[model samples]
Target chain A: MKQEFNITVFSENHIGLLARITIVFTRRKINIESLTVSESAISGVYKFTIVIKTTEDQVKKVVSQIEKIVDVLKAFYHTNQELIYQEIALYKVPTDALYDSDQIENIVRNSGARILEITREFTVIEKTGHKEETQALFEQLNQFKVMQFIRSGRVALTRDPIERLSEFLKERDAFLNSMD
Target chain B: MNKEPMKVTGSEAVILSLLEEGVEIIFGYPGGAIMPIYDALYDYDKKITHILTRHEQGAAHAAEGYAKITGKAGVCFATSGPGATNLITGIADAMIDSIPMVCITGQVASPLLGTDAFQESDVLGISMPVTKWNYQITTPEEIPDAIAQAFFIAQSGRPGPVLLDITKDAQFGELEFSYKKCKKIRSYVPETPVDPFKVKAAAELIDNAKKPMLLFGQGVIISKAEEELKAFIEKTGIPAAWTLLGLSALPTEHPLNVGMLGMHGNYGPNVKTNEADLIIAVGMRFDDRVTGKVSAYARDAKIVHLDIDHAEINKIIKADVAVLGDAKKSLKMLTDNCKKNEHKKWLSEFNKAYDTEFEKVIDKDLHPTKEGLTMGEVISKVSEATNHEAILVTDVGQHQMVAARYFKFKHSRSLVTSGGLGTMGYGLPASMGAQLAAPDRTVVAVIGDGGFQMTIQELGTIAQNKLPVKIVLLNNNFLGMVRQWQQLFFEKRYSFTELINPDFLMITKGFGINGQKVTSRENLDAAVKEMMDHDGPYLLEVVVEKEDNVFPMVPSGASVSHILLEP
Candidate 1:
């Protein structure tokens, strides 16, 4: 019953909000495989895209609980099929290893990666793909003594373009205006 | 910009907001950081009654008792550092038990927040893990909104404790105060309206089931849905059981109201849970105490969990039909669609275990057998003395379980005890709150000697206020519950459970309250009567059997059916 889930959370940026949000997941003993927070299209609202391996039931409850936090505007869980997602990974290898090597270029081309820079000490290659693909490219280049490697957490866009949180805010503003 | 509102100091805002919220009483202790609010309180003396408890913990428990009994948010006040830390236990207790409390803790000036200022601590940070929600107010402007939000969060959904930590500067600062009650939040929605289809489906399931049972919890009283629940039980003729907090929800005398269901619960309900075809749980979470060993607990029963919190729906036992909404509305909906059917066979099965339990445990316990001043006998005596109408606030331990088992209630909200938290020192101060909340009723605090000493300082609060709360310290000279566990499981290695005593009567006398000690069972009835009768706060310590254990107990982590009928 355990499958990959992408939990998307929209919230107002507040001090200690991230700590509070992480505490929720920590208390539930749910591991966050990858988590990324960034400014959303709506001004002042931030979006957190978290990848968690859990059951659908667990994901639903977690989303509902996350939504309970005062700063969280809305939270939702989605399967990979419902989200267009990708992670960008950067690989740094010794420049000497790539010296006059057509093999390094062939590996980069096959993995859909491109060299961003070639310094005196290292060459940096950036790859944009699913997690498995990035890991695969890293394994293929391991023989060249990669100096450093880093991968960004998943950044996702939902299948539907219509934003639910905006609608909610519109309704809330109407209510507040009516009260005035 | 909007028109500026009339100006008031932060302390004034707090006072006005409390008045607006209809808070009649508060339990608290004064200190330097909270002086401004206390001073403001003095000016508005006519609007509120604040009982200065001996300790912050007592104040917290007292607030809990008030909230539980009155179905409103109980308020408490504390100063910075040690004062707020002392309230930690009570706050955690309130949180776990779903008791609504708005705890206001005063902090040092905002500028000195992170600095180690005099009597300064990060109370908001310390209380976050334990509280349902918390807010820190830096100015008077935040007082109205913060307090409103605190109350709303504390009382809504699965009600729990919420703390407001206000800096000292805020209490002294002035701001334009226009108080607006928080009816809704941008994100925090407490009530998720029930689905009619889900309710109908649950009703249909109930209508079709042969052996239907209802397990009610504190949510009934919390939601004020006792009548709706009663109608549901009467309509379907299903035998209903109670979680500890659910004890007084259905009158003990009701035919369908079977008995308690937990580790120290009755035998009938525990055993019958496994055999029931349909288990309709309302308002109560499937706590581990209620469902002994999760794997073996009601495995055959098709569960229909109706609760306000959606997260609790399938957290434990998977609900075959989940009806998520307020219990009042959900019960009404379920009741409207169900067909009336008499489950005589199912009812008789419960009777069989009752017969077994009565002969094996209840009969011997309630009626004494030379075990001097048996706990059950003392409770029976108290029940008789008060005509079964008193508000019983019991502390946790053997005494609490014994009092809960024997004390008969005529109405709901009559028994207030720490169920989920199981806090040991809750009785005395809670009794004060109970008496204050229901001024006419006799509030008896049945506590163990160990638990009694924990908050015995509250006797000062009682004496000062002249609140007529009867204190029954069941002096076993041991942490009796843990001792029972030690005896039963740890090869009778009663390590460190025994207590060196002080005379409770003398202690009570020191607090300027009447006191009595009864060792002989002969004086038990008279002593209980005297305490209940002449009590403008009286302490009666009854020395009971030290080695006796509460029976019909399902050993921890075992199935309900594995309950021990006798030692």
Candidate 2:
């Protein structure tokens, strides 16, 4: 069955590593739904969170290939049930609309969103939730006319208590030490 | 740790780094961007030998050939822009075939990068997908470590090509240079630890099978585990077959060796692959060509795949038991765990199939009574004359298949051809590197008319070096492989597959190399003998039948068992 998969990759922070990781997806014609990169908890190591709608088999192969990159320390894939993920979206609306209706404030409250700032020209509202939830908030605000909207790529963490990369590194270090 | 770094120009540091890596020969073409490196090279004539190829592509292929023959990472040099772009094909070719090569291309000055300066190109971006690893050095201090990493990565694990793009400024700048060979990288693990449990499981599966088949490829040669493989085959007495890249890993006459496997491979291997109870694949990925239709390929068999690359496992044909590690260690472990079993009944079945193929196809191809010369007979003749010991480097085409099928190899690493990429012009330049690497051995390049013209300019390199490379040109006046496909599948449209005229002998003479042309069967033997007897490089063009087809073929999208003996 085809469903959403969250692929997590840990690597050394190197130039062009993002392109290298993305090309693996491009070659296989797999469209990435969302991608996020940031420093991991470990010093000097980077983390990549990529979301794609693909079969389990395809995702397995993709993760294997991603791990094949020289700089990639390790890669793993998980289902929605296995990960805690969210996307932050921002909405800009005309400030006149906010004053014209109390419904806009009600809609914002119901969507669990907060207004960041308000100027005479526009009002900026920020929301952090699942993609569908953010889209729902945008639709409700679209009634009063949303001037602009933007959403960040998915940021996710596995439900597992320990960081998989650290475990992998420890095992690898042990092996290397044994070799010595 | 106590050694002090000596101040030297980056170009000199580059040369020193290569020397530290024990690189003795470099194939390259000089240009403005790389002039500094070449200038530094001028003073080190006694320390390092550089061969100036006519084109950057030829240099890369020569490096590939050198690497294949010497079992070391071959080094190549080229300038930026077009020079770097030209090496792309060879780099891609080496990448696909897992040939270890370190290609150093010169870029414009650091400030001129991305400004579209003269001879400036995004070599790192262009070569990213193809190279095993690539880095750009804008500072002189980064040269040594970058070059060291490039060589280490290129030759480690599943070997592939690596590119290092150094800016002109870096080459001109001076730095305190001290070489430290890279012993390890925190992120990369070149060797996968072999699991004893998996090896035991694989051995159990192998011992339990009634009909077991061993399929090997270049991994045997790359791992230098030919003896281990032989022991494994001998202990189990399994009917072993080889992929094209795996051709010379085992001697052709090895009794347990069945034959080649794939589209135009031997009948026994193709048919019996479907009938086998277990398939032991070592260091060879199940390429589409080898596995006809994957859904039906070895459907009844349990596969045990042993490879260094984990990505290759379950990529095509899924293995029931996956043994991850170098084939050398894994094979030895499996052999130790495996029991002695002579599957005499299974052995007879392969022989029966071979006899049928020999009577039906091999006889006619090897000893044809037809009016024109067959590619098979010419290859057979060459094999017989060379005593099956010469290193055969072939270009891609019908000629490649013919050479792979008909040529006999008595030693490992005797065949160097572009197997995965099927690069057309690989033969000529590769032969030069092969000869230089193994100067005592005869390096014969078997090239088709279509492929020969692709890299014909390489004749200048052979002429300049006076490298004793025997060239055999099989001129059929057509791209025989595609023409055969057209005849069988496309209703004989021809479609620009036919070539006009080229006086090959004249071209060779113009390049100052010995040449001959034989159009008749009566003159074939003498022409070959004369070409082989010549002092240096020789081109012997043999005009064969225009429309000859390679048979025992598995048609596109068909099962391996559905292979046909004739068109």
Cα lDDT tens digits, model 2, B1-567, are 224799999999999999999999999999989999999999999999899999999999999999999889999999999999999999999999999999999999999988989888899999999988999999999999998898889998999999999999999999999988886787888888899999999999999999999999998899999999999999999989999999999999999989999999999999999999999999999988899999999989999999999999999999999999999999999999999989888899989999899888889888889989988889998888899999999999999999999999899999999999999999999998898899999999999999999999999999999999999999999999999999999999999999996899999999999888888888988888887788999998999998989989999999999999988
Question: Which clashing pairs does model 1 show?
Answer: none
Candidate that would win on lDDT = 2
Which is the leading candidate under TM-score?
Answer: 2
TM-scores for every candidate against the unseen true structure: 0.94, 0.99
User: Model 1, B183-274: lDDT tens per residue?
Assistant: 77766667777899998899889999999899999989999999999999999999999999998988888899899999989999999999
Model 1, runs deviating above 4 Å: A1-3, A54-57, A79-82, A91-110, A114-125, A136-148, A160-180, B1-4
Clash count for each candidate, listed in order shown: 0, 0
Model 1, position B327: C-alpha lDDT score: 96
**Candidate 1 lDDT score at position B194:** 85
Task: Write out fnat for all predictions, comma-separated.
Answer: 0.41, 0.66
